[model samples]
Target: MTALQRIEQGSALQQTDDADLVARIDMLNAIGIALSSENDMPHLLERILIGAKQITRADAGTLYTINDQQKLNFEIVQTTSLGIKRGGSSARPVQLEPISLYRGNGSPNNKLVVTYCALNNKTVNLPDVYKENDTGFDFSGPRLFDKKMNYRTRSMLCVPMINHDGKTIGVIQLINKKSINGPVAFDDDDIHLLQSLASQAAIALTNKRLIDDLKALFDSFIKTIAASIDETSAHTGEHCRRVPYLTLALADAASRDQKCMKDFILNKQQRYNLEVASWLHDCGKLATPIHIVDKSTKLETVFDRIELIDTRFEVLKRDANIARLEALLEAGHDKDRIELIEKQYREEIKQLTDQRDTIRQCNIGAESMPPELKERIKQIAARTWRNCDDELVPFFSEDEINNLLIPYGTLNADERKIINDHIVVTNKMLASMQFPDEMASVPEYAGGHHERMDGKGYPLGLTREQMSVPARVMAIADVFEALTSWDRPYKKAKKLSEALAILGKMKQRNHIDPDLFDLFIRDKVYLPYAREFMDPELIDIDEPSEIPGYPFDMP
Candidate 1:
């Protein structure tokens, strides 16, 4: 009977211990929520420290992170009344020992200690610090105990904060367990609680580190790309620089434009796309030969077409000479015939000089090719002169070279096509690109910049209904920069009044959204935008167009 009673008692004791362990698990859960939710790292650490002391009945606590150099560092992230209050700021981190220090080989005196906790990546319990050999290294962490903090050392229970990657970030050392009634064993319950909290802290620290690293890399990348594009040309100056600024502005504008743009609101993912789009919109221009982009006049490529007309003048001169020579022969008037032919030559030359004036101001049509112009080509073909690399594809293809005829802007027809195709190239280039999950929408948004409200845009003429908010925002920013920018190849910039008037007309034509334009100007979006990237001379309101000399009609 006595033996049986003793067995029953042992069983009961085991059950009680299990219950105690389970309760400790529940308490740790409560503390985990608090630690994880707290954005203030110091406060979270302090709360966690207090919870640790409560679980273990520890007299004090200290947390330390190991540095890349494998040194033990202090992070008095939290502590309880061995009576020290956390110094208002977060504790400076130190590294006295690394993961390397924890193995049995490193001299304990040669470096800070990483005991059993570091080796197994688990908790280590010591009933009394005074009884053990001092591992030959400094174990000092600040304390609130009487006298010198270094003088006090006691039993410690430490847990390593090992992240999912199996890297140990720091160690939580619970020192001097003390119960209200008296000292209690730093039992399994206490070990379990500290381990759980350490786990949570590990994840937070790892996440913070990853996020910081990514941000640094992204900023560096943005700066490098911007610098590279700026190096391309003097004209692309402030123009490219202002893209991101205005993109953000348009994003904000779109954000406030009610539900019409509700789906386009630049959430986290959309903003990421905008960031890449704004930087890379003109990337295709990088591939374009320099002369074409800056082809200030129609004849700019290799030979001025105007010069070809001069050759026609040569033909007309010969024709006049032939007529004079024939007339003199018939009249038997040789006395002044040679001199008369020479005078006729001079008169023909004078006529040809003004011959180019009419053609220079000829009416260029829209993108469409005009049959009349093709016929004119036949008449002008008779006047061909020096041809040098004239047939090369200087710009993009056009059906009828409509805009070429009108010269609404400086672009003679061909240069206009090259400029227009920039968007097409932008689309094709971006289409092949692969943005990460967070930025997957980039190709669509950047490519849609030229899209019109009435489906009149090129490449893909997605109507306003099909266009995304990001695309619309890009459109607004693109136009805003083109109008207000201080750099370009041709044509003096129109007054703000004129630029806005054109955009307003576009709005009326259903080529642009009226509400968005109104919002853009009314908000004075360009004021601060100009401040950010415009050169001092360009920013001056007095004919801001003169700096770049707003293209008579920018291609």
Candidate 2:
């Protein structure tokens, strides 16, 4: 055969016919599509390096990415012959020093071949680095590496990965082409194929990085909004922070359960979805008024109206004293008559003091006010007193009457409705955001946390079957945080036992998820959660049986 024919036929051991060449090109095209579709940076980078090595049959390879500091970072390295690997799928980091693209004087670094290729946007095809003298690039580092690792330093093909804007983002370095007989130098075909792969890889990497940057920006925006909401109420800021953690913890526990692992297991994207949802669960509270949110007593509005009531009681006492003195004056100099009038005056004062004390006690709104207390409030409200208008009027106005008549908590019905409207606002606010496919369920999951399992929840009356596990988990987290929280103005932080008992009762009444509650108790999700977020004093230990509805034995 002629010498030309022999060369055109390619190497005898690694023969490449027209058909084989076409098949490899087709495979390269398929790999390019796959690379572009990969969203993960680490995996995409690993795939790029591995794909280059596979196509060229290189025994060793290294991938470098250019950093903002004008340095080439060693991202992935692989040497198959010695079973040496670092970074990427090896789960180990590459410890090699970075190559700087510029020197201290701000001159382009052209000594190292990788840095030179990246600086010039050129491809370096060195058949044998030890014998190369054409480019005047340094090979001392490779020689030292070969000596230290006891490896041969032969052919090298370095290709610059250029993005759409003709900027070099990285370099792909391939070492020693392997064959059945011995190591072979890289040829023109290898160089051309690798360059094409490098181009596709550059675009893919650039796209993935862009996506990552955008995701980071979006998350920052979400957190900023959540932080603003938290800032609106001092008491709820920590609550906002704690619920996400508890949600993740309980969700993770549920994911590990053997009984329903298939149904509950979360992928990386789904976990992120749930986490973002948990953080934004109570964002609707931002629209609520601070006065209603911080109302600590029934008569509180700018300040406690109970103070004004006390002033009125003082006026009544003053009037009683004046009437007693006038009656004594009318009795003239009769000592027995004066003593009787004075005795009656003392009784009147005692009764007035008792009524003042009763009204003060009713204003506190600490516990549930009984029917008789409410009725007594109405009767006391009916008693006439002279006002600044110089007309006899009821001691308590109608509005005050309504406020003091609140059967439970500090807020009246209207204020409670205002508080509940926040969830509706939250649903509306999140619904307007254009979430990506991976996080599409964020709104639904976050919005449903306030909904009841029995269809009694406000805004949207969703039933148990209508809610997702993540949403249900969020509900539990929200309730648990509120129950154990000491910062709220309306209620004291319950002990761990008390909180669990309330949760148990909620489970029994279908206010929360029963199966999830059982799993929560069984897996002891609350203990670790309390340790992380709850006060040490609030973590009171108790038996599962003593908790109102905790299931002792796991099914």
lDDT at position 19, candidate 1: 91
lDDT of 1 at 173: 80
> 326-425, model 2: which lDDT tens digit per residue?
9888999989999998898789788778888988787777658899998888888888788888898888888899999988888899999999998899
The clash count for each model shown is 32, 0
Extract clashing residue pairs from model 2: none
For candidate 1, write residues 28-139 as lDDT tens digits.
8888777666655556556666777776778777776677756556556344444465532545443233335434566533333444455457566767555555554344
Q: State the displacement of the C-alpha of residue 98, model 2, in Å, after optimal TM-score superposition.
A: 2.7
Specify the highest-lDDT model's number.
2
